[model samples]
Target chain A: MNQEEIIAVQQYENALSRVDQSVDKITVLMSSAQSLAQQGTQIMNCFAQLKREQQAYEAQFKELKLKLQSDLIKFQNIVKGAEARLDRHLDYIDKWTNLLLTRDLGTMDSQELQYQRNIMDAIQMANDNFNKELDKLYSL
Target chain B: MGKNKQVQKSSLTDEDLYTMLSDNLVELNEIELFFNGFLQEANVIDESFGTVTNIFNGLSMGVLASMNKSDNEKINRAKAKIALGTFVVGQVAKGVGSFYSYVKTLDRANDILVLKKEKAATWLDSLHRNYDRVLRSEISSRKILTHLASLGYQIDELISNREVYDVKKNLMQMALEQYRKARFNVFSMEFFIAECKAWLKNKHDSNMQQPILQDVNNSIIQEVLFQGDDYEEVIAEFFLGSNEISGSILFVLNDEQLLSHYLSTRKDPLIISDGVENKHINKRVLAIFKDNPALEMSNEFYEIRKEIDEDGEKSRKIFWRLIVTGSLLSTLVSFFNLYLFCRLVMAIDDNTAILSVLAIAALLAFGGLYAKFEEIYKELKNKISKNRENYERYYRYEFALKGGFANRRKKVEEVVGKSFFDRVGKAISSLFDVGDSDDHSFYYEKLIEREYWNPFFVTVSIMLILAIILTKLNLFFVGSLVVLLFAYLKMRMRKKYFYILTFIVVLCVVFLFLYMKGVI
Candidate 1:
């Protein structure tokens, strides 16, 4: 080629190389963008999944809480029944004490007096056991 | 087997009989209610299944488009994976929805049973509270010896009341049954939800595992980058071509309305063949022209064009019918008049009478021809104006497409330009009628689809011809009137029909009254 043609050829080669470099750079940048977009989408989907799971968890928790409350009420009712029985026993003890105290222990036979005392003690023990059970139920 | 069949045939009192029947009925009703509710819930679940699958289908398609890379095999493999993933997701959702619905039904049944149990519990509590009082009140020396031989007298007081015990037992049994059913339903729901979550996670992980396009050096990536000048072109190319970067672009331009509108408006039948609903068209157009702010038309342009076409069509149809009917009637009248004139000249020898008859016939003929011509002129004027408006819309849309780049604009213009009106015009002109039919036929076609003319008008036209023939025969005046009545009724049942009917009735009543009064 002539000198002028040679200069043109050199310029064309330089331009071609620059264009090739630019293409490679663009490809890299575009690919990065694509990956970023994909990641962003995945992130969005993750958020959605998390939200749905959270909602389901909340529903389950509500059900569990209701169940716990129901069990508590049931335990309370059992405790109340035990307490009522204890109260009735206490009432019987008070009535018996009145009947025994009115008769005068001094005039009563020793054996009969001893028997009454033992009965009172047994009633007291039973009442204590009932109260203990009630307390356990309440704690539960 | 029924309870009655299982129960022994024992003699019972009226009260016991009533109680047993009611108890059995209530139990039967509960069972019936559960099955009915379950079946209804199943139907709702089935209905939602289609929707859930469709949602996943759309999602997978969207994901596929967004992850648009150049490799055909990779894209196809990704497509298959996405399809399978979506199917799994759909199945999971379907299962979950169905299980949840079943759970809800069981929960409802459980709720009713719980309420019954609570009622029974409250009653039992009341009984227990009064148990001591009842015992103290009822117990005599002899009663204590008979009942309270042990300290289980209080328990016997409740247990001895057979009715109360049976009712409470039934309530507890029902409640337990409901709880069991609900528990099973809940278990299934939990399983389905867990499976769904796992499938979702797996799908997500698999999606993440796909090799990211880190370099855009390939011809495919280059082609994608230079697909079109605008967002719409990018969207279209992703839908149409195998672009490796579709996923990225779709995610970036994540307007569901716009995407749907684009897909629907695409001319390729294989693409979204069903055009988006009318409501979405303007939004789609605006989205496509978002970058081109200088575009003259607003969204209102579509509404305005529709309104103009509708209003213009109504009047044009009226004008066309009037012109056609008037011309036909006028021509017939003129020919009849000319024939009469010729007959008078040939037969009648009285010069004055013939001249007068000729003069009258000429005047009548002239008047009819003038009216026909006037109507024709009016019809032409209306069609020309309507056609001009429709044609201008095409050009305005075309100009809007000429934005930053020629190729992109050309594509957009081609899309928006070849819209509903243009397509109808082209279809009609090519297939059916061309020359003088252009202006009227385009509007008429649109109008006809909205208005049922073929059945009503054709019937009326046929009846009118029959009526005219019957009248010509002079055989039945009442028959012709009946035919006319039938034709009138064939018109749409709108306010106008009522008004016309009322008008005719009033006219008939007036005529009848006047005749009765000897005033006419």
Candidate 2:
């Protein structure tokens, strides 16, 4: 071969070497970008998870609030009913006590006395029942 | 040396022999390229302008070449002018041709856009659609439901009607929808009424020994004008907003005459003349006209009266309406221009030309829209300025009040917060308070729990339930109970059909809910 042929061959080899080095650098950069992209994707996924968790927490909080409201409503109804019943009983007791105390008892007999005792016992029993009912209500 | 001299002498022979072959080859290649370029340009020009430039160019050059000879004494100058005229005419033809071609390409691009529309829709809508889907995935809490309901409430007050924030846009849309239905029940009307009521109530309940009109200048004048309204003070504010007018009847008469002149010219009364009592006409007109003094002047007042009289033959409403109409027309023009722009961009196969044209068109369109809204923009801006001055006056008046009014306002807020428990307590104490929507619902719910059920009522209900259960075991008893219930219901509703309707409604609602829950 002549000198021109040898010089052309050398030039071609140098160009190939430069291209080979560039290819290696490009490969490294691509791999680094791929890793960064993977990390970015993971971060985005974590954010999505956090958003979902926040939604779940809000849902739970809402459910608890509703449950509490329902319970409160029910308890209030019971208390209201109990209060009405108590007021009725107390009003009757007040009238009965006033009547018994105010009544004239000069002509009392044994049968009447027995009847009075029975009435008193019955009244006491009613009072006890009312007290028991009120105690039971307060616990609830 | 003899051979060199002979070769030098014979060089022309060598060059001549070789030159003929190379020159022909190079010239043929160059000529082929040049002709191809010219042919392409001609084809584009012919396609775009439909032979306008191509045919017209030859005619124009011929005309110019003929016109140049012996036109004027400045023969050279005439020749130069002809050259310039020809160049300009040629360039214009080419430009028109290119634009036509560009517009055609833009139309083609529009067709492509139409084809790609669904795909673009998917990209733009997907995120918003996703957000909606996620938000709607669950059955919302009652509070959330209430919040959603309240979200559509009509805005009572806003500084600007059309100028909107992101949230305000949504609010205004809701408000406008409701206002369309409610009409007179608009937020502004409600706010005005409420403010008036509050002001009047404040006046009546005022702790101060002196009457409200005692301190203010011309208090009797205001009292005589705006009598018996709970919102007398609020009405007074409208009078006060005219920047402390001279209390003279002459000044008032002059002002009225000025306003009357404007109204006469406009051919419309500024005052609310309709439904006003006939007892006092002029006084009421004076009262209301003081609020809006714009009828006191016009753009015509700034210029020469003679010019204005000629121009003022037209209605003022028509003038503004014309501007609004012009804006609408400009919108149509912009839409057409957008269409043309698309066509233009499409015709340019080059990206650079397309981008440059797009930028230019967009800038023009935005600038044009700004110009269109200039009047309305100025009006709103002026309102803000006037409102600021009025607001300062209101603040000063409020601050100068009998000390406890602002404190009472704070107390009112506290009362609102504390009254709920008190109301519930009152419901328990008072039987009439039962079935009241707010207080009754609370007590009624509270009294019916299984654990603390009112023993007396509970026993009665339990006995009733047992009796019903025992009776229901027998078909005869069940039929009798149903008959009794039917009789009771009939006494009130007067029809057995009401029972069937109620049953059907309940069943339908239950079924609907179940179906919605996917419970079959």
Candidate 3:
């Protein structure tokens, strides 16, 4: 292989590693959100107990509990969406790595080059979806 | 042959493909970093929710304790009285809190106005700089292009070196667009500052309605939301647009590689091709090149300004409502005190009914006057103290601005030699510092010096002297009338006569002290 091809291969490997690291980070975020959801559930349970004992403030407790429950559901959905997008991105990266490894850069046809560009575009789209989920989580 | 050329152009080489991949990698890395930063901020917000929950829990416990019932009638009546007292005190506390918040908001509004003025000056300087760097260069380039075209040079050949001509044209266009956006920002900020000033002035006017505050608040919220919408536009136009046409060009014009590339491509002579249509230099581009450019206002400033206005508006409304409620409650309490006085006089002597009634009337008058005086003194003291601090802050800001202008002028003289650029710098500096030269600092200093001689202090002293004299002379009703008249004058008098009123108050206090000591 030529020096340019070698450099291209090195860059591709670097990109794969970066994508892998991003996937790991997303997993950590999902777990943290899961714990937060559990905490929210516990707080809701405590509110329910308080409502039973303090009938005078039953309306306030019910309102708070409902809000917490809705927030927890929203948080779970965001985590699920983020996880799915991260998986899709990993799949795209895998396809990209396979394409690079199997084909010689100088010998690739127009169809193969188009397919490579398509894979990169898919990865970018997945990144955008993940970012949207993060924005949802932030709002929640 | 044309089809073959088109096919060749459509297909990318290995090197081009690798370059594209590298760019994508950089973009992915940026996205990842953004995600991490967002996650960290979200975590902090999540932690704050725990504190909120704890506060809610404590409040619920307190509510439960207050809900418990008692069996004994006397105990129940006492409990009811305690609850009523707590309610009244809570309302008064809320009023005081609101007043404090309103004062703080006014202070913040004044600070924001000073900041906006400073920012306006900075923007003016940046506008001058941009005019010299971007607009002048664009104008000269357009003139050169037009001159060359008129001399029969083919624009296609001239623009073939995209690195030299096209980049410069694009930069100018982008800069002009940014400047246009900046002009809109400045206008909006100035409008907000004007609203804030109006709100401050309205507070001093007792006749100002609540609706005016609401209107100002609504406008502030609309401005804030508008700014948020503008941010999305900026991200799309500025950042995304930069990415589309050589990302580093707009941010780093003086980069070594770009400069070298431009310098190397500058040697091409103007050439003409017959019947070739010009694509690079459109009419719109040329028009923008001729237009003036302004400075870009940062989004952070808009965010901070919005927060200040919104917070101020909320506090002002609270202060107005609660203070009125507290005043009504105080009047009710005064009536209750009169009822108590009548009961005591009846219990003292039932046989001498008319004498007892007269004595009760006199006692009631004295008690009502004392209560009214105390309320007035408390309110006036609070307001005067806050106003004093605000005036001091005003003086400090004026002093700082004056000092800043002097330093700026000295720096211009020291750093810049007597060249054309230096002269332009001096002229612009002087233009912005025109307000400073008008002796605003001197005016503020004089105001601060006279601030200590407040009208409220004078009113308090005069009330004290009247109370002591009338009590000794058995003229309670006359004293009450005099006190009422003084209160009316105190409300009506302008702040400018503070020194004169203070002198009168001091004189009265000295005279009263001597009389009490039997020296007068």
Candidate 4:
């Protein structure tokens, strides 16, 4: 080849080499882009997992709160019932004591003994009820 | 020699020229594909960043809701830790995304730099100048023509029209335009990376010693979840050096108005109101002054602030003492009443006289206690109202000062219109009528001023009258039971329902009265 034709051939080779280098760089960039897309997908999955965990935790917490509130109400009701029973027992005892103070007993009489037995039975029943309530509260 | 060079240039055949131009065009197309790939990566990073922010917002809301909803300290701490962990994880994800973006941007920038240099070697004037037109016109036309050719259309005439379209020139233009766009994208990416770095730096600096994360956790636990006595100070300290105050912070603090005021006016001088002596609002004001040095504070205002703080401390002590004393007395009274009620019930079946005496005593005691309680409540209410009035006055004064002389004048006019002398005159006139000096006339005027025709007052008066009539008819126990039922309904039911019940009871009472009088 002549000098001008040789020069033209050399320039073409140089342009081809640059294009080769550009393709290599482009290939690397495309891979990096693919990796980023993968990373994005992973992040989305993680976000969904986190949301699910939060929802589960909230629902569990709400259930626990409701259980505790119901237990508290149950305990309160038991205490109130126990208190009313004790008051009734106290009133019965007061009446029995008043009867004893007023009635003079020289000997054991069936009528006074019956009245006393009835008062004692009522007091025993109240005691039994209070114990049952106490057992219920402790179980809770 | 020039003629020999021209002949040598023509020595290359048309086929060789077309092959070289087509090869260059293919390379340009590949580079354009890479640019598009880089752009898609950026979009991915953008979407991930958005998701991270969304996660952060969700975590913050969770922390706030958990703190507010739960009173259990352990649960609150656990929730706070979880929230902090999730936030840290989100931040990590964001950091990774940023790193990837930074790397890709640098890579793209380097590619564009090479293309810029290549412009000198090629026929293009400059890559940055011609890239856009080349990409839009030449590359787009090539794709469209190829698409049409694939659909069975012959476009050889269009392709061979060299005068209308030069292939090499179009490739050069496309490459240059793509280079320009890539360089612009690099510029934008670099700016975005810089912003990300700055944000990270700010976060690091703010979270250095007393990290906002830990502070928020502590505040949520101490102030919101537990409501510790020093909550005001805890909240104040939390906001002292905070650069970013989120909505969750305000929500947990439970005093959005106060915190928002502190934030909005942190740069300005502090204003202390008279009633602020009871609350620890001045601590937050001082915190503001500490955070922003540019804020101006007058010595007089500072002294007033100090004096008010001292007064607040003293009043807080007294308030606590009052609460303790009041609560103890109330508990004692309640126990006494409960005991008396039990005794009365026990005595009911045994001794009628004792029962009657005990019931009367209990009734008198309850009435006396209620009257005393009402008096104390009214006194406390009056004191609170007076303090509120003073606070409102000071608030208006502060507002006026901020709003300039025109507002100050307007406020002054308003104050003058409601002056103390005018209030005293109105009170005196309410007590005594000027039109009539008779004592009965004064009583009539007083009744009118009291609005005796008010529905509530009318209801109460009619109920009382019905109770007295029932008692006169020898249904004293029934009268007492009816009164108790009505009182319970009044306390427990809504006003509308209570009014309806009251109307029914009144109608029944009226019928009973008519029947007793033989008029029904």
Best by TM-score: 3
* Pairs of colliding residues, candidate 3: B154-B271, B154-B272
Q: Write the per-residue lDDT of candidate 1 for residues B41-140, one digit (tens) a residue.
A: 4455444554665566566665566556535454445455655676677666655554444444434434443433432333344334333432232221
Which pairs clash in model 4? B130-B177, B131-B176, B131-B177, B131-B178, B132-B177, B134-B173, B134-B174
Candidate 3, B126-223: lDDT as tens digits = 33332232232223223322221222222343234433333333322322222222222233223333333433443211122212111222222123
The 0-to-1 C-alpha lDDT of every candidate, in the order given, reads 0.39, 0.35, 0.36, 0.39
TM-score of chain B of each: 0.22, 0.18, 0.23, 0.21
Best-fitting candidate, measured by DockQ? 1
Q: Candidate 1, after superposition: displacement of residue B161 in Å? A: 61
- Tens digits of lDDT, candidate 4, A71-101: 5456556655544554454354345434433
- lDDT score for residue B367 of model 1: 45
**C-alpha DockQ of every model:** 0.02, 0.00, 0.01, 0.01
- List candidate 2 segments past 4 Å from native: A1-25, A28-52, A55-59, A62-72, A75-140, B1-281, B284-520
Give one digit per residue, the lDDT tens place, for model 2 in B1-520.
Answer: 3422432342222223223212221112222233233334334433444333333454445434644453443443443454455456555655654444333333332322332232223222322332232222111111111222222211212212223222222222222221111111121122223322333333111122211211221221122212333323332343333332221221212232222322322222222231122322334334423333432332222222223233333323333444455444443444445445546654434444444443433333433433434444456345444443343333223222311111111112121122446534433333221222433231112212112112344345434643444333332332343454444445557466867855864675576546545587
The sequence of per-residue lDDT tens digits that candidate 4 reaches over residues B1-520 is: 3422333343332233223322232123333334445555544654566586556646545565656666656555655665676566666656555554444444443443343233223312222222332233233223322221122211233234433222222222222222222222223223323322323332111111211112223333343333454544544554454333222232232222223233223332243322234453444433322322212223344454455445444444444344444434433444454445546654333344334343443443333334433444455455444443443344333432322111100111121113347534433443232221324321112111111122344345434643453244322333353465556557768999999967865675566546545586
iRMS, model 4 (angstroms): 51.3
TM-scores for candidates 1 onward, in order? 0.19, 0.16, 0.20, 0.18
Candidate 2's DockQ is 0.00
